[model samples]
Structures are given as structure tokens and as C-alpha cells.
Target chain A: MDIPSYQDMLAAHERIRPHIRLTPVLQSDHLNALSGARLFFKCENLQEPGAFKVRGATNAVFSLDRDRAAAGVATHSSGNHALCLSYAAGLRGIPCNVVMPHTAPEAKKDAVRRYGGTITECEPSTSSREETFARVQARTGSEFVHPYNDPRVIAGQGTCAKELIEQTGGLDIVTAPIGGGGMISGTCLTLAKLAPDTQVIAAEPEQADDAYRSFKAGQLIADDAPQTVADGLKVPLKDLTWHFVSNHVSDILTVSEQEIVDAMRLGWKYLRLVIEPSSAVPLAAILKNAERFKDKRVGVIITGGNVDLDRLPWTEGA
Target chain B: MDIPSYQDMLAAHERIRPHIRLTPVLQSDHLNALSGARLFFKCENLQEPGAFKVRGATNAVFSLDRDRAAAGVATHSSGNHALCLSYAAGLRGIPCNVVMPHTAPEAKKDAVRRYGGTITECEPSTSSREETFARVQARTGSEFVHPYNDPRVIAGQGTCAKELIEQTGGLDIVTAPIGGGGMISGTCLTLAKLAPDTQVIAAEPEQADDAYRSFKAGQLIADDAPQTVADGLKVPLKDLTWHFVSNHVSDILTVSEQEIVDAMRLGWKYLRLVIEPSSAVPLAAILKNAERFKDKRVGVIITGGNVDLDRLPWTEGA
Candidate 1:
């Protein structure tokens, strides 16, 4: 499998600039005081369709040849990526078919529908998802857009960290949540080329510590039955993602479910920004290990804000 | 009593430029779809202390004499204004006291404390609030900062509109909620001069539409029994505020409690920003009368985002 290089990531940024939003990097005095870190939050949570997934999705959609684009696009995602790809495809005047599991949050499903994507519900299993997506591709003759394994997608996601580095002078450490490891891998790739000394840390929930364990053991591991409030982090580690994580990532830190909830609440109470549990992992990790980040310039990628209001982490304050 | 002219408002913008945040102007496509009008949201909800009240408070704090600043500042408010003044006073190294009504939300009281303000609770009546505040001022020798009536405060409030007009080129109309009319008066003064063709409208909850009735009656009419989810808009219109509303305001529109709640939900669901009912009034009005503003470019001031999480509007959705 061919891996994307630093130059490819830079090229992808240029390719996706028109399709992707250069999301704002917000400075938080309150958050800075909380951890003693001069923190710059790359607010990907506020990106188009409320996630950084749009960057990769836009890049993938736009990179396709006119003939391929005309054939349409297909993907399987339970959350932000599905909606993002659908939205990006719709913008490019192409049809999108998303194979979302039945267990996916209603809010996400609604967003995908709103973006004019045809949805096919599958059982909550990788085999089921793959089989269903293949059927979708066969039925519609659409090109399958891999969520993260694809080099173009990884390079596209790297643009977020590129913008972060440009927006802030330089970050001492960059932290992002690792699920399928797309965001973190992209972030690490950008940081490696732009500022090699800057640490690239992957934050993951303890319940779903596949990336964390894999990084520590130097071998890919999959969390078969991950249990966490962060539904987005349930996807198991992939080989390409593991390769990116093993080399470029400096460390992987695990945060508790309670910590994720606390971070989400803090984002809402202090930042006045709604963030999903998956996005909270990095913040939770920072707060848990304040000593590691104190007096340093840290960048946190707020992955997404597509939270289900019904199942919100209201239990924290309760 | 001297009313703030458009010129005075511009001068206020100059005065507070160094101290206050020129808050972000965000366009909501989802709201535009629902409202018919292309809605530009001036996000004062993300302002310092999470409300537009900080604009006036900061101006008041900075404008005070050295002697007056040393003596300190005091006010009575149910929430945002008191906390805003407390924060502004804290910045200037001055003592801040808030004589809040006993009925004020705990979240509001907590915010005041977080900003380092001493709270003195009084009975939930105007006479009681005035009497308590007067006693506190007499005992502490702190300059009393009225929530809305003061000219300096009005000037500070006007700066928001001035900034909004500057950010949005020239809006066809500007809408803000009217409680004691501090923000609306400032908004009208700024728009009436800078964007003369811009319609300056006030959105009030139908349950607490004293300003709407008074606008029509051409006389000051207080709500004998005000009831609305928007706690900030319960106050009666003051003399100085009435003068501006009577003269410069194009019209006052009323929105139902349901509409206010729905608008607040939409703010969270679509914009992914938490907004208080008061902030949602303009949006509520827009949603209710989409035809009235067809093709018009509308500027809506989202006043605050300080709602209690325990009592989130999503509970109703559940």
C-alpha cells in the first residue's frame, strides 16, 4: 500500500482549499488558565457540516476524474464522515450513497439525509458494513470512498493541522483523538514535516484504547467491544492508520469516559461550544496530565460537535 | 436626560475598541432556509462574560473617574448585566457588588461570583431591588451602575450594532431583543446613522411585550404580570430607553414562548451554539414571519449564551 508523503499532504491542502473551510483557531484564556498551557484550539468542530471530515471528503470527491464523479460516490460511516462526504458530494453535483449502521445516532442519520445522501442501514459489524457498501457500489456503480485508509483522504485530513500551524506561530505539542486514526494520523504527518520537534500525541478513551495499546506495543490492536460515550471512537484500528501512528505519533494517552464527559461539559460551560465525546478525548487527556503540558503552547483539534442532544452527557453535572 | 445620538454611538465604538471584543458576525444558512431572510448572526453570545452586557459594563468601568473606580461599582440584575459589570470591574482592579433578586437563577448568581462580584440578594420586586441596592451603595460608597438607563451604558451597548454594521457591510434590517432596551437603543442609534435605510426592529416575547405595546400606544406601559422564558426581557422600559425606541425603532415584533424555545433549540441544533431565550427572540421572530423578510438581508444579535444546562430545552424534545 502506498503511503502519502508530506509533499502529498501539502498538495492535498492546495487541492482542497476551495472545497474545505479554513476553520478558525480560537485562543481560550479560560482553558489556558485551567491547564497552565497557552492553548490554541483548532476548531474543526466548527467546520462545514460541523466536523473536519469535510476536508478529507471534499478532497476525495474533488480528486475523482469527471467520469468517476459522474458515476457517483459511496461510503459507509456511522457519524461525521458520512454527512461530510454526502455534503461535499452534493456540493460537487454528484450523488452520494451512505451505508450507516442501524445503531448510529438519529441526529447523524438526519444530517446525512438533509445533505441529500441515500442511506442504507446495515448491522453494526465491520463485515456487515463492508458487505453492504459493496452491494451499494454494485447497485449504483459508485466509487467507494474509504474513510481513512485512502492516501488522498489522509492527506486531505492533514490540511487541518497545516492551518493550525499557520494560524498559530508554532505548537509545542499537537493532540487529537484517535478512532480509525484519520485525524491524528493527518495531524502527525503535518506536524512531522512542519515542526518535527513538536510532539504529536493521540488521545483515546480508555474503553477504546486500541490505538493507545497499539502505539505502546508497536503492533496493531483492535478493540472488539469498545465501550465509551464517544461513539465516533468505536472504529477499530486500520493497517494504514497503524503505520502512520507507529512512526509519526510521539505518544498515546488514554482518558476515562467520565473525563470525556467532564471535557464536553467544560467546552459547553466555558467555551459555549457544543462538542461531542470523541472531540473531548484530547481535552480530557490534557486536563488529566496538566504537568506534561504546563507552560507549553499546545494545539488541540476539536474533531466534531455533532452531539446527540437526547443522549448528551448531562449525567456529569447530575 | 440626554439621549445618545448616532454620533455619540460612533464615539462609544472608538472608546471601547481597546477594551471590548469586536464580536464575530456569523451567517446561518439553516436559519435563512427557515426564515426566508438571509440571517447574519452577530455572536455577542461569545463575548467576554458570555453576553453583550459586557460591552456596556466595560465602557462604564473604563469611563469612570479614578476616584470613582477606586470607590468601586454596584448594580442589581437577575443575571447577565451583574456578571458583566463584575468582570469589567475585575479588569480595572475595582470592587464589584451585585444586588441580585432572590429569584435570580442560580447559574446567573454563580457567574457573578465567578467574575469576583459580591452578591447581595434582595426580594423579587422592583421597589425591593431599588431599596436594597440603594442601601448597599450607601453603605459601600460604590457608584451605582444602572442596568440600562445610564447614558454611558447606552453608548457601550450601541457599539455592538456599530461593529455589526461594519462587519456585515450594510444590513437591510437589524433585530435585537428589548428588555430594558439598553441593546436595542444602542442598536437603533448606530443603524439610524450608519445604515439609515436599515430597519431597526425589536423582538420581544409575546408574554412580555411591554415594549411592543408601548411602541404602539406611544406611552410607557409596563407588564403588570410579565411571563416568558427570556428572563432578561422581563424588565420595564426606562425613560431614556423609551425615547430611542419611540423615535428610531421601526417596529417591535412579538414571539410566543414556544417560538422562543424552538429558536433556542435551532441555535443549538444547527449553529451548535448555546443561546439563552433572550438571544433567540430575533430568531424566533424571523422563524414566525418568514414572508415579512423575504430576500432581505437581516442582522440578528444573539445577545447571550448563559443558559443553565440542568434546564436545557432538549428535555422537552426528549
Candidate 2:
């Protein structure tokens, strides 16, 4: 697959404009003071599918050729991507198939089904999901829509940064949690051209820091099954995402599990935003590395809100 | 104090616009499908203080004359109003003294202290609160900004509906939880003049349904210490609020505690909004009286989001 051009992001925006919400940017003076940064939250948590994955999913589902569309779309995701693709396919009246780990949050699985996606459960690991997804795609003869890594998906995800840049003024740095680097890649793909002065930074959970390790080692690294409170961020970076991360991203930061939980609670209290654990990684990083972000105008992407409300990260059992 | 005029609301908007967030509206197709109506959620829960009360609070605080502002402002509230008033006072660099029931959420108390408000605890009853507030107000010589009844406060709250009308296509009906009838009165204040055709409705928790009783009986009734999960809706309508409710509001609907909890969960799930139980009452009312809202465009006000993250209503201990 070829790298998506600047025009691809623009085209994706126009194509998906009618389908998605132009979610609002949220800010808190309390958060700014706590971290000593003027923080702008790109609340994709309020996105139509409750995540930014809809940007890529909708773009891919709609971009499919008429013949290719007939076969429907399929993917393997930790959670948001599956639900998003299903939501997009449901809009186009097409079938969707997803391979999710059996340990995936019940809320996400329920959402996938609610959006008419059929889910196949696999062991909670990257390798297992890929193996399961291959069989499902082969059996169904469906178009394979990777959760990240694809040029089309990356282009679609890039639209979020376009809106973010359009929504805010002169952002010094843009940060997002690095799961498979889909959102960070999108931020890079957009800012590298649209706002060349803006820096792209990726935050990752300490437990799932494959992207950070890869950045330091100067090679791609894949983690099979890293355990972390941020369930949606357990996966590792792919080739497409790595290309952008390696080229455009300024730095990658990792936060401890406790920091992720702390930031999640702070986001809930100060921002009063229903953000998922994975989404808190950026804020956690900012708070832990205060010197790096202090006094800078930073845009933080709240990646998703598809949390199992019954199981908050800070709760005892959870 | 006199009834707030349309010009009062317009002026309040201008005065408080800089201090508040023009919070976004949220919608969910699942919620629309469930209730069989086109629903627009005016997300005041995303307001700067995590509630719509900030609108009235800021207006009241900022509208005070120099002499009055010097002494600062004080109010008696269940939760949001106190925190919001404290927040507004903090912004204006003035002292704020609040009378809050001991039963108000811990989150709210923490927030009030965080914003530099001095909280004096009272018994968990409106009479007890007012009695304590009177002594506190007389001692501090602070301007008393009634949580809802003051014309300035009502006018300020009215701006929410104005924004709602501007943000969405024509709404056939507007609904809000009726505590002291502040928000509902504000809606009436705006829609009565701005969108004369739009019907205003009030929702209440059955455990504290004084507003519903007052609207049905054509007289104000006070419920001193009614208890419900929606802590913010425990108060009764005052004379000024009754004036608007009697003249402009078309109906008052009450929902069971279970319905409020169910709707709160649904709001969290579908809207992906961090809403308090008081915010859910409007949705609960609509869901309970589905046929009343069917085939019509309804604007539901999510009043506040000052909820204790640990004690979600659906959870066992909560």
C-alpha cells in the first residue's frame, strides 16, 4: 500500500464529514495549573462512535469500491476499532466482522454487536488476534481493514488532527496515547504538513511501551500480550504507523500504571470528561514530565470513552 | 427582584460569556431509537464548573456593583450551585462563603474548597440551609445570590436555552430537571420569548417531586428533606421560579429513582457524557413518557456532572 498524500486526508474529511460529529475542544484552568501547561483537549471521546476510530473506519468503509463493498469489512481490534468499523458498516448497510480478545471489555463487545458487527473471540494477544482475523477474513471473503497500519486508515485518522488544528490556535505540541500508534500517526500525518511547526508526541503505558522501546532501539518491536489497565492500548506499533512515528514524532513518553489511573481520575474530576484509561496516558505523561510541557500550548487527544463504567481503573476489584 | 426580561438574559450572556464555556450539544442515535424521538442533549455538564449552574453563578457574581462585589457573594445550594458560585467568585478574585447541606456530595465539597470557597455545613434540609445562610450572610455582609430565584441568576441560566436553540435545528420541546426550578425557569424565560412555539417541560425525581406537585396543584410546595440519588434536585420551587413554571412551563414529569439510575447509566453509555443523576432526570422523564415525545424534536438539558466518581448510582454501595 502507498503512503496517503496530503490530499487523501482532505478527501477523507469531505467523505466522512456528514457521518461524524465535529466534536468540541474542552479545556480546564485547574488542569492547566496542575500541569503548568495551557492544555486543550480534543474530545474525540465525544465522537459519534465514542472514539476517534470512526474517522478511519468510516473513511475506509466508504472508500471501498462497489465490488469490494459487497463483501463487507473485517478487522482485529482491542475494542474501539471494532465497534467503530461496525458502526460505519451499519451506516452503509454492510456486514462487519471483528476478532476481539475474549478479555475485551464487555461494554465494547456489547457496542460492537449493537452496531451489527459479529465478533469472534480469541486469546488476548496480538499474534492470536491476527491468526483469528485471517481465518475470519478467508472464510467470509471480506475486505481486511486493519485497525491501524493501512494508508487508508491512517489518512482517515489524520482528519482528527485537521479538526484539532482548526479548532485551536497555534498549538506547540500535540499528544495522544500510543496504542498501535494510529492516533499519533494521524496527528503526525496532519501536523507534518498542515502545521509544520507543531510537534507530535506519543504517550504510552509503561506496561505496553513497545513503541517507546522501538523508537529508542531504532527498529520496530511487537509485544504479544502486555498487561496494563489501559486495555485498548495493549497492542504494538505496525509498519505504517512506525513510518510516521519514526519520521515525524518528536518524542515518545511512557507513564506508569498508577499514573494512568491517576490521570484518568483527574480527567474525570477536572475535565469532567468520560475518558478511557488509554486516553489518559497523554495527561499522565504531561503531569509526570511537567518540565517538558510547562508553559507550552499543548493539545491532548482524549482517544476514547468506551469504558466499562462498572470497572473503573482506580476501583479495588477493577 | 422582578421577573427577568429577555434583555436581561441577553445582557447576562454577554457578561458571563468570557467566564463560561459555550458547552457543546451531544446526541446519540441509540438514545433516539430507544425513545423514538429526535433528541438533542445540551451538555451543560461540560460547562466550566461541570454544570449549567456556572451560567447563573458567574452572571450573579459579575453583575454585582463594585461595592457589592467587594463584599463578595454567598449562596445556599445542594452542590453545583455552591461549587459554581465559588468558581465564579474565584475568577473575580473575591471571597465566597457558601451554606451547603452536609449531605451534598464529597466531590462538590472538595471542589468548593478547591476554588477557595468557605463552606459552612448545615443540616440536610432546605429550611436548615436557609436558616444557616441567613446568619452567614448577615455576618459576612456578602450579597445573597439565590441559587435560582434571583432575576439575575434566572436571566443568566436563560442563556443556556438560547445557545441550545442556536446550536440545533428547531426544537419542538425543551426539558430540564426542576430542583428549585432554576434551569426550567431559565428555559421558560428564554423560550417563552425567543421560541414561543417551543414547549417547556420540567422533570423531577419522584422522591422529591415538589415541582411536579406544585405545577399540578397550581401552588408552591416545599419539601424540606426529601432524599434521592440526584442530590442536586432535592429542593423545592420558590415564588419567582413558580411564576415562570405557572406561566410558561407546560408540564412536570416525575421519574422513579430506578428510572433516574437507568437513564444515568444510559447517558453514560450512549451519549458518552459524564452526567450526574440530576442531569438524567430529563432523559428518564422522556423515556418513561415516550409517547409524549415521539416524532418530535426534544432538547434535553444535562444539568450537572459533579458526581463522586467512586460512588456511581448503579454500583452496590452507591
Candidate 3:
């Protein structure tokens, strides 16, 4: 797999600038006091499609040539990426075909449809998703845009960190929740060139600690159907994402489900911002391991604000 | 009761500028489409104490003379006012004594204590609250700071509308939920002088419609014990607040309990904001009486965000 350079990230920023919001950077004195760190939250939750996924999706959709753009884009995601790609496709007036799990949340399905994406439901498995996506892509002759692994997508995600660096005037460290490592890879890509002294960290749920395990083992470790309340961080890292993670990440931290829920509640209560469980992973890591971040200025990326309010993770039986 | 002038609001803004945040004005394309009007939400939820109450509290705390300042401040409130007063007192390094109902939410009491205020619990009634507050004031020799009736607080609340007018380049109408009429009076105070052509509106819960009744009757009408899910709006208006509401408000609207919950949910879902039920009242009015605000540039003051997460109104049996 080819690696995207800093120039590509810069170009992606220019391409997607008009299409996405420059989400605000928020601070909480209470959160800072609790964690013993000066934390600046990059609120990607305020993104147009309600997640950082819009950066990469918009970049991919807009980077296409007219012929490919007319053919449209296709992706297999039951999460924010599906909805975000659909949003970008709608913005560009192109067709977006999404392959989602049959058991996906109704809210997620509704969001994709609302964004004008055509959805094809598949069995809830990697094999079924890939098989279904392949058939749909072939039938529609649409370009396949991997959720996080593609070079264009990684370059696009890097724009978030670029904004973070600019917004905070550099930081001692920057952290983002790692799912398939799209956002973390983008952070690594930007920090590696723009602010090499700044440490890049990845946070994940302990229930789905494949990224942490992979970092410690010095090899990519894939998890099979790991369960976690942070539903967005259940996927394992791919080669393109692992390339950045293994090489550039200073550390991979893990937090328990209870910690994630507590952090999510704290973000809502103290920060007064609507953030999802997946977005809470970084703060969970910071609170659980405050010694490492003590007195340091940390930039924590809030990845999204897309959760089923009816079934919050902290609710009984959720 | 002496009425607060625009000059008082200007001075209040200058005094509180260094302490309070200049909250952002957020626009929602989807919300505009839903309501058929351009809405600019002044995000007071992002204020230091997680509500707009901090503006008035800080203004009052800072406005005190040295002798009175040394004596500190006291108030009787069951919601955001108690916590905001505490926050302001903590900022100014002064003692803050609060008399709150014993039945007030534990979270609110904890917040007040967290901000270094002394809480004196009273029975959940106007007579009990007043009797307890009188004793606390006498014992502590603190300056009595009425939650909404004071001129300093009214001036302080007016700063929010001043900021809103400046941020949105002169809105056609301004609206806020009327509790003791603190926020609405402030909106009236500012708009009446700064943009006299702009209409100032007040929203209230139908279950707690004392303000609506008073506006219609052209006289004060206090509810003995009104009930509403919006705990912040249960209080009746005072003479000073009534002065502004009566002289400047163009209309007073009331929404049902279900409408408040629906508006709160819609704000959380679409605007990606964590606003209290009281703050949602203005949006509820806009949604219900669309023709009144349709095609107009409206500034909606989101009064506060201090809701308990575990007991969200939308949750089953909540």
C-alpha cells in the first residue's frame, strides 16, 4: 500500500475546506482539573455529518475525476462513515451506495437515507459485507472508498490534526480514539511532518483492544467480533492505518467500558457538548492514566456525536 | 423597583467581559428548514457554570461595593441560579450563601458546593424559601441578591442579547424562556435601546404559564404551585423583571410539556447541543407557532444547560 505524504494532506485540506466545517476547539476547566492536564478538545462532533469521518469522505468524493464522480462512490460502513459519504455525495450531486449490516440501528439507517445514500443491507460479518459491497460496486460501476484504509481517506483524515495543531498553536501530545485507525493515522500523518515533536497517541476500549495489543506485539493483531459499548471502535486496524500506528504512535492506551461511560457523561455535563461513547475514549484514557499527561497540554479529538439517545450506553440493559 | 438601562448593560458587559465567556452564536441549516425561519442560537450552555445564569451572577458579584463585597452575597434558588452564584463567588473569592429547596436535584446542590458555596436547604415552597433565605442573610450578614429581580442581574442578562445582536448583525426578533423573566427582561432591556425595531418575545411552559397570564392581564399573576418538566421556568416574575417584560415584549407564547421534551430532543439530535428543557422552550414556541416567526431572522437565547443525565425527560417513566 502507498503512503500519503504531507503534501497530499495539504491538498486534501484545500479540496475539502469548502465542503466541511472548521469545528470549534473547546476547553473545560473542570475536566482539566480532574485530569491534571490542560486539554483542548477538537470538537469534530460539530462536523456537518456529525463526525470526523466527513473529512475523509469529502476528500475522497471530491478528489474523483468527473467520469469517476459521475459513476459515484461506494463504501461498506454501518457507522458514521456511511452517513458522511452519503452527505458528501449528496453535496457533490453524485450517487452514494452504502452497504450496511442488516441489524444496524434504525437511526443510522435513517441518517444514510436522509443524506440521499442508497443502502444495501448485508449479513453482519466482514465476509458478507465485502461480498455485498463488491456486488453493489460492480453493478453500479462506482469507485470503492474504503472507510479508513485508503491513501486518499487517510490524507483526508489528516486535515483534522492540521486544524488541531493550528487551533491549539501546537501541543505536547495529541490523542484520538482508534477504531480502524483512520483518525489516528491522519493525526500521525500530520504530526509527523508539521509538528514532529508532538507525541501522537491512540486510545481504544479495553473490550476491543486489538490496536493496543498490536502496538505491544510489534505486529498487526486483528480481533474477531470484539464487544464494546464504544460501538464505533470495534473494528481492527488495516495495513494502511497500521503503517502509521506502528511507526508513529507514541502509545496506545485502553479504557474500560465503565470508564468510557463516565467520560461520556463528564463530556456532556462539564463540557456542555453532545459527544458519543466513541468520542469519549481519549478523555477516558486521560483520566485513567493521568500521570502520563500531568501538566501537559493535550489535544483530544472528539470524533463524533452520533449515538442513539433512546439507548445510551449508560442506560440499563444497553 | 429601579429599571436597568442599556448603559447599565454596557457597563455590566465590560465588568463581566474578563470573567464570563463570549459564547458563540450557532446556526443550524436543518433547524431553519424545519422551522422555516433563520435561527441563531446564542449558546449560553457553554458558559462557565454550563448556563447563562453565570452572566447575571458574575455581574452581580462584581458590581458589589467593597463593604457589601466583603459581606458576600446570598440567594434562594432551586436550579441554575444557585450554582451560578456559587461559581461567581468562587471567581471573586467571596463567600456565597445559597438557600435551595431540600427537594432540588442533588446534582445542582453538588455543583453549588463544588464551586465553594454554602448551601442552606429549605422546604420546597415560596414561604419556606423566603423565611430560610431571610435567616441565612441575617446570620451571614451577606448582601441579598434576588435571582431575577435585581437591576445588576437584569443588566447582566441584557449583555447576552447585546452579544446576540452584535453576533447576528441585528435580528428581527429575539426570544427567551421566561422564568422569573431574568433572560427575557435582559433581552428586552438591550433590544429596546440597541434595536428598538426588533421585537422581543417570551416563551413559557403551558403548565407553568404565569408569565403568559400576566402578559395578557397587564398585571402580575403568580402561580401558587405550578408544575412543569422545565424546572427553571416554575418561578413567578418579580416587579423589576415585570417592568421590562410589560414595556418591551411584543408577545408571550406558551408550549405544552410534550413540546418542551420534543424540542429538547430535537436540539440534542439536530443542533448537537445539550440544552436544558427551559432553554428548549423558545424553540418549542418557534416550532409550534411557525407562522409568527417564519422567514424572519430570529435570535433564540438558550437560557441554560444543567439537566441531569440519568433522569432525562424523554427516558421511559422519567
Interface CA RMSD, all predictions: 1.6, 1.0, 1.0
Give TM-score values for chain A, per-prediction.
0.96, 0.99, 0.98
Highest TM-score against the true fold, candidate:
2
Clashes of each: 0, 0, 0
- TM-score for each prediction? 0.96, 0.98, 0.97
DockQ, 0 to 1 scale, candidate 1: 0.55
Summarize candidate 3's per-residue lDDT along A1-318 as a digit string, tens digits.
Answer: 999999999999999999898888888889999999999999888886789999999999999999989999999985799999999999999999999988776767888999999999998767788899999998999999999999999999999999999988999999999999999999999999999999998999999999999999999999866788787887789999999999999999999999999999999999888898999999999999999999999999999988788887777674
lDDT of 2 by residue, A1-318 (tens): 477877899999999999999988899888999999999999998887899999999999999998999899999999999999999999999999999999999999999999999999999988898899899999999999989888888899999999999999669999999988888888898998999999998999989999999999989988889999998899989888999999999999999999999999999888878899999999999999999999999999999999998888788575
lDDT, model 3: 0.91
Clashing pairs in 3: none
Per-residue lDDT of model 1, residues A1-318, tens digit only: 878889988888888887666676766567888999888888777765888899889889999999999988999986889999999898899999999889888989999999999999998777888899999999999988888877888988999999988988898999999899888888877888898888998899999898888888889977664678898888887988888899889889999988998898888877777788898899999999999999999999989988887667764344
> How would you order the candidates by DockQ, starting with the best?
2, 3, 1
lDDT of 2 by residue, B72-182 (tens): 999999999999999999999999999999888999999999999999999998779989999999999999998999999999999999999999967999999989988
| Predicted complex 2: DockQ | 0.74
Candidate 1, which segments miss by more than 4 Å at Cα? A316-318, B5-11, B316-318
Model 2 chain B worst lDDT run, 10 consecutive residues: B309-318
B13-86: candidate 3 lDDT, tens digit per residue: 99999998888888777789899999999999988788898989999999998888998999999679999999
